[model samples]
Target: MAGETRIWTPIDYEADGKQSDCLRLPHSTDLSAYGWVPIPLVCIKNGTGPTALLIAGNHGDEYEGQIALSNLARETRHHKVSGRLVILPALNFPAVAAGRRVSPLDEGNLNRSFPGDAAGSPTQMIAHYVCAVLIPMADIVVDLHSGGRSLDYVASALVRPGRTAEEHEKLLRLMRLFGAPISFISDGTGGGGLTTLAAAAQEQGALALTTELGGGATLSKAGLALAEAGLKRLLKDQEILRDVAVEPASPTRFMTVRGHSAFVYAPSRGIFEPAADIGAEVLGGQIAGRIHFPDLPTREPETLFFETSGLVACRRAPSLTERGDCLFKVMADIDVGPDQVSHA
Candidate 1:
């Protein structure tokens, strides 16, 4: 952990102290120089054991996760932590303000640009900074997220596959601490990459998990409360905080996806009418939605059916469909090893 002590740029480590200002990344430009900007990172570091980093705002449209993280920072500012707590309330500052998924400058999705490049696109630089600086310093990491922009998702903890029974149990315990109703283990649903910071942390052998709230291009008090309470539970479970009373997790059924499930799409251009809701279980050959032609009012619309059985984890909001556009994604139930899958 000697080399791991320093993350990203140059910032001296101060145990359990507040810094009134954020440290600015060198050569970071404002909107005047480039079409985008990087704001100084406002970090609150506390405690002195293994570090745990809490991050949010990777996708601008997922506002609830960011807000939840921000709210936790405010409530726990004076918290006496046992381990180092690094809070990056908002990583994609510009995107959060604009309410979009990708960086507005190059329209790049920041989550996909891991271990970023200084001379690359704006999003790339952000990935580089987070991967190089913040991630290396932590023993465990919890990334906050939700469906971006036009998608709606059920709240769940997406964990990697192929863990020993102990690892799996530990992860489940963490999920219960997250206080979410569902926990979907990511059995290679998201491919390995340099784009996502979560992947970067996992690659370093950290106990990493991504907590997704229920929101897309919107925010809600319920979602925010879940996020805050989940973090508190995690911190307490990690032994970083001493006085939190965490509820024992109820018996949970962990489902694994058999393979890359399909996101049902529009067969033709027209308005889409979905018949199912998020988190609803569907069967193979089930009619989930229909595609209607705007001009051909007299002609009957085409109904779309599911090819496999699983949960409807994501669905388009407008119920309006476009040709070849995905309207729903089915997460089929299957068994997979925790180490066998990695969502980089």
Candidate 2:
């Protein structure tokens, strides 16, 4: 460790580190209206192991995942890592400030605009920075996420396809290192968005995994704890840290959703009453929820049901409902087979 240079990217932040006051890296530019956001690309420069990136807050509303990655950056400052660790805890600052799903001005979901252009919109510029700057430099990328808005996500991982079976297995090992309770595998390329930055890392042949830690808007202690444990596991798995323990689960149960899936929505506007819970299995034509028409005869409540069979991955919020509103999403199981399909 004598020859190693532990470089911390200095930025214009508050004394308590709550606010971003200035750019840490001297070479900073205002890409858009978001002001001088710091691109904290620090490195140990030992030149001995793999370089890994941990990113979060692609969607501003997912606070738990953002907090987990932020805490990791703060706690591991003095740790002797085997390789480089780049942490971008909050990528969408404006949106995070508003506690909204997408940027308020452009009304763009940063996750959807991937490999963004420099001269495009503000979100595009950020996307462009991510793709052009941090991504290419990473050897392994872990994009952290949580349910944005009014939803909660069970812990899961989404991996890209096209890796060799051996490489796929290796990717799974790294995903497990995060130690999420449930590990879901889908092709990373399927979703065309800025959030698919993990897939971009995979495209570069860097072992990548995108994880969902908890729900949206708020932080859960259990979710944060799981992510903290998982990150340490990942650090040990990548040889960036020592004395870490791996939570062993032989034959890890991973659910796969391949190809196009049906998203069930409420056909008629009414108060929504859901019958099934998240992670529930359903048969085709299963009655999922009811849209009770307010101030009606109440004899014919509009029934919402699944068209195909799978799991209830996501559901709409609350008693409020509108015509053509999404009630729940059903992902029909497909064969991933030898070919890997890109999933979001």
Candidate 3:
């Protein structure tokens, strides 16, 4: 009881049919001393089998995952499911409601708050409930994501390499089955790596998968279609969905994000003029883009170059830039082999 989460849900996770409810996270504010934030939750159970925990809205501005999970929650019924399906379409309800990447309540990034505290902020409480409660009940976990307002991604599915070779293989198989255009084998060492939901799930022995569908704080038609189709295929293949007719997975290119060289950052605050588009293949030392000072039109624009040769997997969406802002992220093809399955 020392580390128990304060959030409580009325939905019975073991029930035979579908149940929808809200996870009540306490928010003691001036307006209402007894107020609670309602985080939407849907659980579908049919007998006993493996459980799949699907989540989205870790970053609120990411639209693809939010829409996909919302559709799944609305469309799916208990009769169609062979096992259990737990859907958390908007995990960070505060951020999702504000349409922001971080929660306005405490400016907390849900993705960076795993293994969270029971006595922490609202975001941490939600994260604690997820890792301590939901993840343990899952055989597999799928977290959908996108670039949000700052960047645009070339639709890709990512998996964190497991601790053992056998576990790694299982994760790889699931990534391929999702059938995104690109399969990324991530070492999970950047941007709050170990604190991510994927990492928490992996540490708990649950096969975890994440995706980057699209970005720019808007819905992408292509990204939405891929999310819908891939989710159905994954569920059916895992035998969680019984009667769904899912199409065979298409070919996915294997890739990985190497070292710091894979990223391009803005050197100073200026307007960014990109030289390469998202998904463009670039060589090392290639001119990535230029930073222009609008105030000093007479001065020359400072050009930036790529440090690694690879495909541009993500690019900054906004033209206005700031110092140290990530302008580009490049990904290289992974040489699939027995020994090269996991990156160090």
Output the number of the TM-score-best candidate.
3
TM-scores, all candidates, are 0.85, 0.80, 0.97
Q: Summarize candidate 1's per-residue lDDT along 170-253 as a digit string, tens digits.
A: 665676567676666763433434346766777776777786677656776666777777777778777877686656544434
Question: How many clashing pairs per prediction, in order?
Answer: 22, 11, 0
Residue lDDT tens for model 3, 243-313: 88788888999888887878999999999999999999999999999999999999899999999999999
**Alpha-carbon lDDT of model 3:** 0.90
Tell me which of candidates 1 and 3 scores higher on TM-score.
3
Best candidate, lDDT? 3
Better of 1 and 2 by TM-score: 1
In model 1, where do residues sit more than 4 Å from their true spots?
A: 1-11, 23-31, 34-40, 162-169, 187-194, 334-344
Residue-level lDDT of model 2, residues 1-344, one tens digit each, is: 01211112353211222222211221234564433444333233233567677777788888776887767666664346655667777776657777887876477777777766666665666776667666777778877777766565665666665368877778767655566655666664434533567656776677877776667466867767777777777777778766556565323345565444456667776888988777788887888988887778656887776777877776665567778666675554444443634343
lDDT of 2 at 64: 73
When 2 and 3 are scored with TM-score, the better candidate is: 3
lDDT of 2: 0.64
Q: What are the lDDT scores of the predictions, listed in order?
A: 0.67, 0.64, 0.90
